[model samples]
Target: MRRMLIVDDEPLIADGLYTFFAKADIEDMEILKVYSAKQALEWLDTVKVDIVLSDICMPGMDGMQLIQEIVDRWPRCKVILLTGHNEFEYAHQAIRNPCVADYLLKTEGMEKIRETVEQTLKQIARENDFRYQAEWFQEKMPKALPQLQRQLLLDLLKRRGAKAWMNLQEEFDAIRLPFRAELAVLPMLLRIEEWGSYESQSDQRLLCYAAANIAEELLGDKAAVKVAELDSRSLVCYIQPHAGQLQQHGLEQGWERTIRFVMGTLESIQQSCRDCLRLSVSIIAANQAVQWGGLQQSVNRLGLAVFDSPGHGMEKLMRLDITGETAGLSLRQDKLAAAELLLEHMKQRLLEGSDDWMCSFRQWVEITGEGGPDDPFLRLRLLHGIADVSLRTVQEAGLSEEAGREHDLAPMLHFNIHTRWSDIIAFYRETCQWIVLRRRDSCRLDESHILMNIHHYIKQHLDGDLSLTRIAQEVSLNPSYLSRWYKKVTGRGISDYILERRVEKSKELLLGTTLRMQDISGQLGFSDQHYFFRFFKKAVGCTPQEYRDQRKGAAETKM
Candidate 1:
């Protein structure tokens, strides 16, 4: 429905247009008549008008200044100026504004004015649909906020340093993490020691998601846990006990309670994965709760222990035990080789867009950085693997003008795993973020490209076959895929687009050329004139002949 405000200082003209609409065939309109521009503004303050018609010359606020005021206040409202032949000079200035739909000479009849009203309503409908879609997206984005927030927290940790920890503390409330900065946090590292064979990337990803859920679900109540599924089948949980429980016990006792809670949660998680998910997981937790200042080094030790010493079979629970010499150099080399192979497998999983690839990769980098070889030669090999994985993942993500910038690896190339721990972790995280942002952009671009191609194809082939199969072929997409994708992207079906394009083209040809209705119908790919007539009336609220006559009459009146 639409509202039309008719403003004229003259009683006769104002009442006449109001009566004109009251008696007209227009169904969805609230026709209003106001005696003066001031009265129209008063009514506008109370109600929003979709269309405003006012005479150029009034008492205090003339139509020129009145239209300007209405435009600023109700920017969406379309305005039309009515002027006598002498007052037609005002049309020159008023018509310059985008808000001024068109101006009519008072000498022109009211039916001509009603045609303008119908056209404006069509535009308002489009604007309202767009606004509704924008509002809908705003309403839905909050649901994804938790996932995004957790990802941000994990990214912050990868950067390390006091600055990153401080930043994480600041964001705890915003991301709705279930913890406070002052509470004791028990960081638990969960490693999937075995999960049988995995071939498909989708399967690999689903298993990771399943594992993360099992861990979070078991540990969700007393603690605020942020889990990152890192590479090589490890899950890192940043756990903070509820503030109320921590406050009652004081820092020391609360810390002890958190450790016990975390241990119990890990054991439950292991059992759940085995029973419910049918997989084996090893858990390594930080021995003592450390404040944000020493959180990086503390969690690093746990990550290493979880990956290096994943126990055999069901006996997969322990604490950080990496504060010892290696068993033997050759044995360590063999373990590292196995780790490197697992990392390569994870890299493939991520490229496949597996569910928790990013989390898994970060876990791999963090844990492996600890247990990884200290010898410069062996460490260099590990760094190279990390660099290769990072670069390849970034490319798959499509994050930059040139996604495969191996130059980013040049810095890691000169560095090793042991001494440059912080630098490598930071690089890994930065790369992950870059990958995520770019991949999102790529997906959006892909959607936009499909829509643009479909639209262009429809417009260019208005007279040709405009079937879904034809349009899809032109765009090199499957017809069914294109149909759903086009509707999803544009909020309307491909056939709807074709019909709209045909109608718009018919209008242009109707007004611009003296084409016969049959010829025009044929050119628009319509089978016959009657079908075109019904379609034009249904879509435009007027028959094609009525629309053309109105345009012709308006042109002659202007002349």
Candidate 2:
């Protein structure tokens, strides 16, 4: 509802306007009367006033001064000036202030005043509509721009041939990319070697994005830098020296210095990622810059170098000369890729509450055990991957303590502790089975705990704010989801449960206490006694007083 304040130094005028508006039947509008500018300012301090009608010549603070205060406090509130003097200067000043709706002589009848107030309300509504649309576009543009830039970069990364690079400068400009087209750029690939506590794909992507931000922050001053996530676990950064830097140091020396600075900053970036995000990353950068046309080949070379590097879960920084042959890298890459796929599939199945993940684990073990001598590096990679999945699953399910007590599998993650492949495989199999069983028990316990918390909060706050939004906040859940889930779990709606509780409380108060109807209704959170009486009669098939009398009579007869 909109509130309008009527302020005049004279009591007669203020009270008359208030009485007229109170009886005028202005829908959804509340009129308040104040005798002076001081009283009006006090009211505005605590309440929102939509329109202010005040006399132009008051004693201490004139209507013009009050308008300025209102502008500062509530910029949306419209002010109308009324005065006995029909002075031209007052009208001119009122017209200059945007907050002043109209300047009028006191001789303008209350009807004219009422019409002006109604028009001011319509003006407020129109302004609110325009503001909402502008706010929506402002909110959406920031979120949309990033996705557009990412898609453009991905397209450029995959495009081939000179024709693909024809409009490269225009595409970059459209997205506001910092790097200049046709300039030699330094390309670096960042791979998350170990995802400490992050398990979900979304969480992993967030960490990768944070890592990219850290890269930009550290190296942005030296070069024009743009970083984009290639996947959940990796992102690529393209860096080019700014024009001024290139002119000062010549083209060759400028790129050399920028590349050197980037290489030196990698350690700092890695430290920030480790400290802030708890992620270990491996960075591979080219020792020399590559032309825009050859960016994809350079990125590919860095990817192969990462795949061939040993010690899968440790952080490392490698500089590629961009001229090595990746002949023998394919075989190892295939093996690692297969192992990663199998582990991811098993993780998904386990989270879905299935026993078939054990089958996938067995297949992975077979893949690791296949053919041509024992590659300890490959086994080490598989061991760390499985251990990570198992530990994260146990932690996410809140069964870490139980898993620790039941099995001492922590040492299985260490390569030296379980050097034998057979021993590692046996431990891995036992961990998988333990996860399946414990997860089932954890699910039941989690549901029970959630229901208990929700019910307890509802009971304690029966007379307070027990809205769906409040209850969801109490139990840390989304309001809409909680409503649907609670109904599905209890076979009754939450609102129905609340109504039943209120009725039970009302009955208890009626039969057990000598409280008045108003007191009982207030205690039970009803707005008034009449609403309470109607609600109680509809629910219990009798009015509250009638139900109380009948129950008491039945008890007296029994005695």
Could you estimate the TM-score for every candidate?
A: 0.40, 0.48
Task: Point out where model 2 deviates above 4 Å.
Answer: 1-302, 305-328, 341-363, 366-373, 410-423
Tens-digit per-residue lDDT, 82-135, candidate 2: 989889998999999999888888898999998998899898888778666787
Model 1 stretches with alpha carbons more than 4 Å out: 1-138, 197-199, 293-296, 310-315, 321-374, 382-559
lDDT of 2 at 308: 70
Q: Least accurate stretch of 10 residues (summed lDDT) in model 2?
A: 325-334
Which candidate gets the maximum TM-score versus the true structure? 2
| lDDT comparing candidate 1 with the true structure | 0.70
lDDT values of the candidates? 0.70, 0.80
